[model samples]
Target: MLKGNAYGHGASVTAAFLASRGLPLLAVGDLTEALDIGQAPQTSILVLSPPLPEQLPLAVRHRLHITATSPELVQSLSSLAQGRNQKVTVHIKVDTGFGRLGAAPEELVPLVKEIKKCPYLKLGGIFTHFPAAGGDRIFTAQQLNLFLKLKEEVCALGDCDDVLWHAANSAAFLTLPSSHLDLVRIGTLLYGQSPVSVGAEWDFRTTWQFKTRIVQIRTLPKGHSVGYGRKYRTKKPARIGVIPVGYSHGLELEPLTTPLRQIKHALGQGLKGQHFVFHPMGPLPILGRVGMGLTTVDLSKTPDVYLGDSVTLSMRRVTASAHVPRIYYLAGKVKCILANHEVLSPTGRKISLLGLF
Candidate 1:
């Protein structure tokens, strides 16, 4: 599943790659994203939040599954479906106490009743989104309780049949299986990382990595200033390596992970450079300010390396601002590509982390 420019990983490209891996189903935030990847046969599409009536016809034609919540929209969908001589499959979203979408508990009775009469609309599934599936047990429990309640009600519907009840995203599927469900729409998990780092028990294996080379090396006298606004100054006459990826490329300098804390000392003999994780307990802590097209690597200790040496940036989804090519892999081999499609040479890799926000 992909949404919000795919949480910084491009949606269209990511969806295509996941589809290549037999993902089978995809969830998107809106109608546009749904249609973008809807045509693939055997691939189910879910528009997390769909648009209004005026904008839904094209999406229906593209074979996307629009998420339905209200009776009015369900009726509208049936009408649209009648015009197309097609039955529109809808994934009914239940709020499950998140106060977001789906019919409220009291409203479900009437909504389900109204939906059963729509001949052209099929109840593909019943589901909800968990607000704290990765962390809060209390809130997660409440949501799960509400989901089970609705599941019973939907199952009781006279003509509803056996609509799938799916309430788990990656977090819920991994940590809370009461909602493991008939189907799960996972994003970060398939990408092999946690969407949130703090308190998350991560088990998914990462599928890809990012790396670039140092374009140049510069040595400066002590106290020399560097970068725009001169954020960092050379304390001692030191050498700095210029990497070909920076903040503009989706890098967040300083500490991009969890609660930033100062470490006492690094491993090895006098490891000079300090290191930090993206989020406390985050799987990857590898990022530099995404430069216009480069990153500033502090290589004072590793100054003996040449300009052509490469540094791989372990990455999950970067921000939309990061307009770079994405290399994909499956089972330790190059499988597919997104953007430019420049084949990367590195075989062994690691996933680098940056904060979700």
Candidate 2:
């Protein structure tokens, strides 16, 4: 379920579930992430990075669909594909008003013509990244106007029958009405999260949950307190659960106006960077500052759970997605996993963790 902390839900599991659901195509921001999931043969890929000649051969072997915007990139890829005897399928990006990637609206027609002249090169599609689909209607409309102008010019140029038109990303796909585009490349949404998913009305629940067993616990006195600076002074003798995870385990604060925090300690002014695995009574903020190597959680209201008791923390992407570890399951069983350092899967009850590769 792509419903919780992305890393906790397990990347391999999410990848597998996406594949099983017939949503096998994934669009990634760069080559590294594309490479991480590249081993999954069932998943077809589209690399959002601009074309690079040196990387084209690897992209060819990996069967990665790339995005190209200029005559230079198209020319470089055309030549490289020819030298390697491999055909390159590329999606053309347009500069609409976004001024990011893609050629200007006026340049789309001529560029397409030049690309068509390359024998080993295949222009697979046309796509534009929305600069502000969820907000800023003025800029989006201006970009739309430019995109429409390019579309009109291309259709009049010739019948480019095989080209696919795609523009909507996760935010636009949900907020904006679909148009003539053939595909909508989703990123944050597939993990059961989004930039706009807020409040109880938000449909996506986190697909990940993080849990760790108690390492050790000590009964503290009322005035002595616990952890550095003695920031938390217990009102009564209380049993607090000790979990092994800390900031190194990859936790983060969600974006503002988002309900993604789980553990609620009395929030100190210093908690901008530190994060934990659980929420507190009545939405307690995080504790004093996050320690360099360790973090303490306020457990006054944590309950009577003893050592070895499971303490779990849940998260959603209220901010951007963070790089975290994931343990994947199938049918409620651990089938595959993505750790900070390895990729592994279960085959016939035997687990395989790719070592250092």
Candidate 3:
């Protein structure tokens, strides 16, 4: 899955690399994202979301597979494909348990029949989504059973024998192996994250890192106020380093929608005493509230730390701003840098997106 800008790791670069590794098909969230890749990958691209009526022409013209969530969308695609004298492959999405963006189980048969009536539309696959695959095994199993039963009914029509059936997301890919049907749509696992824990056999290492350099260093006297609202003050004379990263870059940002999560966040904040960033020498405590674009760190403990030294940060990858530069490395060497929507080599030469791999 190469949606959400490849989960904020930059889709163009990620798609090129994955294509080089011989991935036959890539999936994205929408038609716009499919166009964003711009022929960088030599593979079939599937749009996993239903396309708008206005977007169907572009989708069919580009030969991008689309997910059919309703009979109305299927009809729109059929008309566009017939007008263009082309065939469009569509995967029927059933809302087995995921309550969003798919035809209900009861509606799948009629939707399938509707697609079969359209000569320009071809049924490439049928898939469903899991809402709680990681935490709820029984629910996921029930969803799978429901999908399989519906699949049996769809196959009885004799036209969908060649249709691919997929339902496993990353969580289900790990927890419920039975859900892995003809194909599995894995996003988080490809990014080296697992919603469910596995044993030692599954050795998944983190594939992305967020880092920033110290741009400025300063010394502040006792009782000096720092950051907005003066939420923190120096207890004594201390050395601080400033990094050009904060909430805007997804640092220290998390969802606190539930009361339990909010309470857990509060308890975690109290237990940690102070937020810190990682360095080879040791941890550097944050000095004040994280700003929108700048954060202050206490560097008194790491006397040898200097300006331009890089420090690793804890950030939600998907929430990180796309404006931030992503430096890709291979075998301990800088491979390419993705910044401002361009891919460049370490020597500052512009690299063709098609030739990235």
The TM-score leader among the candidates is 3
The residue pairs in collision within model 3 are none
Leading candidate by lDDT: 3
Off by over 4 Å in 3: 256-264
Work out the TM-score per prediction.
Answer: 0.75, 0.76, 0.94
Against the reference, the lDDT scores of all candidates come to: 0.65, 0.62, 0.89
Q: Report, for all candidates in order, the number of backbone clashes.
A: 17, 16, 0
Put down candidate 1 lDDT per residue, 199-262, tens digits, no spaces: 5454565454456666788887888776666656777987766776665665543343433322
Q: Which of the two candidates, 1 or 3, achieves a greater TM-score against the reference? A: 3
Model 1: residue 88 alpha-carbon error in angstroms: 1.1
- Model 2 weakest lDDT span, ten residues long: 257-266
Q: What tens digits encode model 2's per-residue C-alpha lDDT throughout 1-357?
A: 122222334444455456665765656655665666535446666777774667766787787778887888888888888988888888888877676767777778888998889998888888887878767756766666667677777878776678877777667777765533678776666657775544677678555676656666666566656566766666677555455555555444432332332323224234553344544232223344445334555555555545666556544332223345455655678766566535555433334332211
What are the C-alpha RMSDs, in order, of all predicted structures? 7.4, 5.4, 2.0
Model 2 whole-model lDDT (C-alpha atoms)? 0.62
